[model samples]
Target chain A: MISRMRILDGTLLALEAEGMRPTAARAAGWRRAVAGCGIDSLETLLPPAGAGDSPDRASPVAESSSPPGNAASRRSAAPERPPSLSELIARVLPTTVVPSVSALANLASGAFPQSGWHCIYGLGDALFADRKTLARSIDSLSEGREALLAPCFTNERGCATALAVEWLLGGEDRAALVSFAGCGGLAALEEVLAALLVHGGLPAADLRGLPELTDRYRRMGGGPIPPAKAVIGEAIFSVESGIHVDGLWKSPDLYELFPPEIVGRERRIIMGKHSGKRAVLVKCGALGLPVTADLAERVLQKVKEESARRKTSLCDTDFIALYSTCRAGKDEKEEGGRAVL
Target chain B: MRFCKIVDTTLRDGEQAPGHAFSLDDKVFLASLLDGAGVYQIEAGVPAMGRDEQDAVCAVKDACKTAVVSTWNRLTEEDVRASVACHPDIIHLCLPVSERHITRKLRTTQAALLRQFSRVAEYAAGRGYRVTAGFEDASRAEVPFLLQAAETAKRHGIERIRLSDTLGMLRPSSAALLVRTAREVGLPVEMHAHNDLGMALANSAIAVLAGAGFIDTTLLGIGERAGNCGLGAFVAACREYTAISPLQARKAERLALPLLSRCRQRKFFT
Candidate 1:
């Protein structure tokens, strides 16, 4: 459950590519377009590798480049290239800001639409390498620096924290770039919200928009994002493993930061390789399946085997099949269904 | 600052994602692309899966013109025989090093495990295929013992040892330290990390900095559970931070990544 005030989302570009629908304006009218997601001209975002391109994009994506000394690649003279960002952005709204200094420079030079576009200067540790020059570039950008203020975060790696503090104290209008998860940005976002709630002279009323803010984020990430992703993965509420499952079963608050209902997700007892009998019993009980102790243990072993065989946690179909197999002497067959509660 | 070689196990580890198995054609296509991208080595797939699997591995080996083709296996002659039949350049023989895995997973003593592995590595060496021993769950193994195991495997003709953070439990600092410690065994250490904590990238970077000669990665980091370090992410970071060869970065940039729809499909967990 998200117990923070509000976090500016950086998922628009990612979500747009996934074809997720645009959400309504938030209560605060803040745009859901990620700060670094919007592009001026997708083609010109990165200079082409050859003439108007970055050196990396010099090769055409269709013509695969074979490594040197290989007869096939020796014939072609170039390796297969990765899809350009433009090609990738074709399906989605090209709203993500170009975090690279080079791409950001291109963005600053290009003419962007007046409305629905907010320029965020993406800065991570790379800024530290040339802080003075990067700072000068930002200071020099005359028109849209006000719109710019996207800081690339890499965990609590000090730089992101320092930049956030500077923004808060220096009165910069920039929003802290919060990745829904990974690179350490998720926890940082919570910290930022906590600080703002306490220090920034903002009232709790201002913080009420976080849930809506979170919904906007969900919209950008598309439907049913991975359950285990750090901040955004739904797997947070779905407990697996014996120790944590037992603890959570004993006291809901013992393991989780908040209730799963807060995030519109439910606490699932997933029977996995490391799952204890409690997880199996809970999941079975929820599905209204009655089983003796031995049956539960048998079902659990089957689940672990299937999970290990498939190299993932068993889904609902797997659970049902296992339960049915345990109940009767019949063999289990793969079925396409899930254990959704 | 030394350059690191990449062995992409997308086909093998990536395919391990629950309900995600690529058709042979997809495997061949991905192989061609990865090879063309100058990926140093391609751990195509574990041929031990079966005949069709063997044929798939052979097809990838035949299709590639440059990338070194390899296959994974357990510490057993039957799996090794399957690996040999596929005709890969390297046979990756995996053995558990951690006490938990040795006791709970493999249910064997360390001495018995080592002895059995030596036989497998020796058999693989005699078969004219280069052998790389994977120390499964090595991070949990005692440092000195792990190095000793590597040295013993080295003596048995295993050319390399892959240090797997099998459970994805190592911190970046510990990952680096493990690589540094494994360096004493005098064989190239390949870092095979999992992403349980989303720190696979950080751990991979630290391994590169700490002198792991090779990094085991998958395209899009598609592997078990949280997945492996993404090939694109690892290459991109390397390009930005280190003096890595531009060949890799260029290929990574231009490679038509599988669409998010495919990646996001619950089946494939990249």
Candidate 2:
């Protein structure tokens, strides 16, 4: 079974980044939404914070009455014990097509999550343990549920397509099956989501914001959506990274051709090589950091230095750290002197 | 050189060869084949031609993923609007840069043509389109006028400019010089050469090496008269020359060849 703690951690992180309080319902909602939308591992799903004790650098917990925000303390907290493999089998075996010998061993051993749909597309040898593993699992599944399998025949892979079609047909149980079309790769993911959201009892209008979610998925996979890609292309809202972030921020609606809520994402200011000083200053004003002409210049210089050192374009965290460092400093020398490394 | 964005205009301009025409399904099948061949851009059609052209553009736009879809437009605002209706990412606006064509075909003074084009381009830009302005017959245009047109485009914010050798009159050396001149004006250059003298591919290669970021090609080199450079042939040449890296060359061949073959196949079937 997928570790509940890991799921919780991922949900909490996505929630925190989205600026929502980490209540149980919010956590569950995020879980349900993410579970419905994708099949990536929990670690792969959330935006990475940093390597090794990178310090809880998310935007200072907004309106915090509680000490040590959820992320701050959760990082050091003990890992929650995951439900045993047998326990997971007991919970999910009832939802599969057939329950057989080897399937019991794998499910009881907790190789897969107890709940939530699993959609694996492309190269099943790498993604799934083996076809036998899938067959055994299908055999062990309970009645009234079916597992969809599409084989790749003659260079054309039908596995992903068949799974997707079954997932759509499976009805209110809401479990889904999906396979990759080999040619489309991750390209078909959005179409799958849109098709599912349209035909699978999902609120279609609510899914109008799916483009942003798909964009987030693309970013998570480290893919660049071509500037002209529909919905979430770089050129749509981005006017050369930071140079236009504030302008985009002011009229987020204008820049937002797609709604933000469908995939539980928000438009953010990304600091990069092309960010304008006015944009930085404006961002500072929003973050409650006082700004001046000299400060903006200093910030820009710091950004350039840090970005070069890190070998990445400046991100929101870098901007926040610079602002936070400036807040703690008394003079320009102290403000500018901190090592970016 | 960096990975150049190769645009095959085979289905659009290729089909425009004197005795050639592609049915809608033929166009879609050819576009799909091109999509697999790994081209970076496809100038699909001239939408202002009619509804049939617009339909071809729509079908290709809906299905293809390997390359960005673009449409060719003349320097008129009406053409730009018509092209916009089909939703191509890049609208390639063409204007005659040569004084001979400007004085005769356009029946206007050089200064008047420039002003009119500038106004039309400004409107296109205001609409937030990525405009690629092509100087039709650029190789024969007077150097100063070519420079002026390019400078005018750059000053008015055109993203890319093309130097079309209308009659394939230039050799590789002249193509290189013309491309260098365009780049000297600080605008990205795309080379569109005909093969009247069987030098389109050679000129394209030289132009690319001289800093042109884009090259236009037609399938099987089919076009008016002796046709343009064959896109598949140009891709192979770029690969052999290592003009672009192995990865991109491989990608271009994969994305462009199948569509070209499909087009040929459909022509046979029809």
Question: Across residues A178-286, which tens digit of lDDT does each residue of candidate 1 receive?
Answer: 4333222322342343334333422331333334545555544535445344223533345455544665676554334445453344566665555678888888888
Model 1 chain B — which ten-residue stretch has the worst lDDT?
B260-269
Q: Find the candidate with the highest TM-score and give its number.
A: 1
TM-score of 1: 0.56
Among the numbered candidates, top lDDT falls to 1
The per-model lDDT (C-alpha) reads 0.58, 0.53
Evaluated against the true structure, the overall lDDT of model 2 is 0.53
lDDT, residue B132, candidate 2: 81
Task: Estimate, for each residue in B172-218, the C-alpha lDDT of model 1 and write its tens digit.
Answer: 55687899999987898899987654557667777877888898888
> How would you encode candidate 2's per-residue C-alpha lDDT over B174-263 as one tens digit per residue?
677899988888988888987543346667766777888888877556654346766666776566432434454445445545543332
Write out fnat for all predictions, comma-separated.
Answer: 0.03, 0.00
Model 2, TM vs. native: 0.41
**Candidate 2 lDDT for residue B215:** 87
CAPRI category for model 2: incorrect
